[model samples]
Target: MNTPAALTLEAPAEHPFAPFVRILGKGKRGARNLTREEAREAMGMLLEDKVEDTQLGAFLMLLRHKEESAEEMAGFTEAVRERLTAPAIQVDIDWPTYAGKKRHLPWYLLAAKCLAQNGVRIFMHGGGAHTAGRLYSEQLLDALAIPLCRNWQSVNEALDTGNLAFMPLQDWAPHLQRMIDLRNTLGLRSPIHSLARILNPLGARCGLQSIFHPGYQSVHREASSLLGDNSIVIKGDGGEVEINPDTLSHLYGTTAGVGWDEEWPALSARRHVKPASLQPEHLLALWRGEVEDSYPQLALLSTMALALRGLGTPREQAFEQAQRFWDNRDTSI
Candidate 1:
């Protein structure tokens, strides 16, 4: 965001990081680009609630105006990295950004749990509460009998046993967690919001994802394109990485220099499902730990599946990833 010269401060070392702050204050507003370490400091202030609401809003809007630079985004990822107990699952897989799942179906958690059950360990991040329209994800995990854990010890234990684990940002980054008030009062997303989606707290090497807004699709790709030649990305329900198979058409995915692929060949592409009332049903299923039922995602689910699966297989295979889960007797996948 807009780094104002007048707002400079000398942290106490006393203040944790005062000298660096003094130097940063000297940084030219327009000429300077934030470093990873500097970004972490910003995160500390944002997360700790040290930044005032107005300032926080300004930071976010300005940052967005300037466009969240690749370095800045990567730097911000540090806080997310520091905010979790490591995933304990022995099997390796990239855990997608399961941010803000309490808004609807705990899609990221479900996908994580399903993958975990199938021998994959997932690293999901989120513990934010602000908008009245949204609820905390921990509540959903609790409803499903899943422990909303706080550290590596508990997380690893859960992963080893139930193939699931939770690492709420509040526990790891209270500074960031406390920002809920900032967001609520400001009525806008802060720089932290952008940082939240790109989190990789578990040190996960890769993940299959469903992202929100096609505009952001490119950022996700650029952020993690180095992880693999076969990286997966989806247009999520709300910027998340899960897909609903009942709807969606061909997916759009790219690997930057790695090459982009479309023309999927996996599952049978079909018309969108149009039942009158399935949101409640899917919500109920989520709490009951029944993940097989497909939720009415307003086409987000279908779109994501097409995008992620279409990367490797044909459209049918990608679409089937969601369909197979819905039609199967076991929804654990």
Candidate 2:
């Protein structure tokens, strides 16, 4: 055989996160969403700090401006979960409370505590002070004397002692927390908020998430399905995983990889006003029987019912069970 001229095949150099940034920033005519795999790789680079800050900011804003797709959100969550040093725990529920409370007390904290008391091993994670004029979960939990765990071991230890444990995103996934903090600079929420809700670091059997925007309900549902997580995304109070008792809320999620959606009726007929002031003590005082409110009480039951249904309880039966738990809560505790 005649010796052919040697072919020179040079590999194209890959720039960290540049491919993804370009995919979203190709202008209106050419911009497109990243595939799931592309998103995963890009997010991996983000978590590893392999991308420049300029690229990170551009990528985030582009995604925000375009609106994140289900595949992209799933990929980001999966990438984060892959990097987590998750403790070996059979978590009954994964509750992400990053949205914080702007209008009301974090009654969801009380709901989680009630579920924990009822033997639901809840793994709650969130960030704090990321937004002005909002009451964060960590602050509210701290007010009630609930310890915020520093790491996986402490989380497991707390769950072993009591069915409840709250972990701040800063301790578990500092990289994502840093990105979340960029909200102040960016002046808008990013995809990080959506990804954090369904991170499910411990691979809990049930995930309870919330979205303030109604349009995100389908986005979260499809994303959870892509992650193979059995989760319920609800229009929660202040988007903090607690049901709004006054409004008919929509629910969406996956169960055993099958997608489902339902509309829940308003538990209370009267519309409740957002409080003039947020008192963290108000959460504890309500739980301790020193204070009482109809709205918070209904919110607690409805939210717990959703969590129960997420854990395989029958829909109507779950509500009944949740009501009993609420009625019998020991006020002194």
Candidate 3:
């Protein structure tokens, strides 16, 4: 009569992605890697909102704590691409910009416009301002009168009319955009940032990307290879697809689904300098020839050269052609 009921605790039900979290979060000796299929399934569950909040947070943190494998990154990206829809227009290049510029104006925007002017159909997609103080491509596109496309239909229409269109990440995939927005709460970037860059929803023949950290270079290279897409991943200034005219750049890429790499020498030997401020007018003026700034010119030409290279132009010839296109650009605005 004096004996109390035996104390007992039951384990919680297993979430679908719980195993994935455990595989990454297990103490070093017990942890293991998830196969590509496993990663694809886990990511599918995440995108479908099948995983619980606790499991989702644990999964994302586990991925952040451990460097993501190429298989993992590629699998997650494959899931995203499968879930998204884009018009079947013939896109020459896939340009994904997630990293906003803090120290420099996004010269890459003008570079994409220049390529579009030369008959290169480009589809640009990106998320905006999570970290503050950085200049996002979306914000700057408005000043240039480039409308943000709402869907594949609008994207197709814009490309048909102008050969270039910018789509926001929120419009393309809201779930992933929600994850990206968590950068503020998580206090660090999760693997979603990397996966978003390689989606290439239109199945474009070529893709261009940039990373802020040097270590992630190989991650992007191998992931792009696994996705079987032609891509160029560079350590661009402020982590954009644009380069700094004063610094040599390492270009990691793939061709016809094969990995290749090269170094883009600096266009100028002078010390690196930052503009006093980012005025959208400066970008417009530069493109219209109202201003003559050597650094910005080199940035645009070199950035476009990389895109042209992805399109199969020889290195030297690509740079030369980019310069020619810039000089011949329509300036009636």
Candidate 3 stretches greater than 4 Å from native = 1-12
Candidate 3 C-alpha lDDT tens digits along 126-197: 987887898888887777756589888889998888889999989989989988998988888888888788
Predicted candidate 1 versus true structure: per-residue lDDT over 190-274, tens digit per residue? 5565555556555443445555655555665565543232345556555556554443523334443263544333223564444
- How well does candidate 2 match the true structure in TM-score terms? 0.93
- Of the two candidates 2 and 3, the one with more favorable TM-score, higher being better, is 3
The stretch of ten residues in a row with the least summed lDDT in candidate 3 is: 139-148
Computed on alpha carbons, the lDDT of every model, listed in order, comes to 0.52, 0.86, 0.86
* Candidate 2 regions with alpha-carbon error over 4 angstroms: 1-14
For 221-277, candidate 2 gives per-residue lDDT tens digits of 999888788999988888789988899988896997789878889877779887889
Residue 302 lDDT, candidate 1, scale 0-100: 51
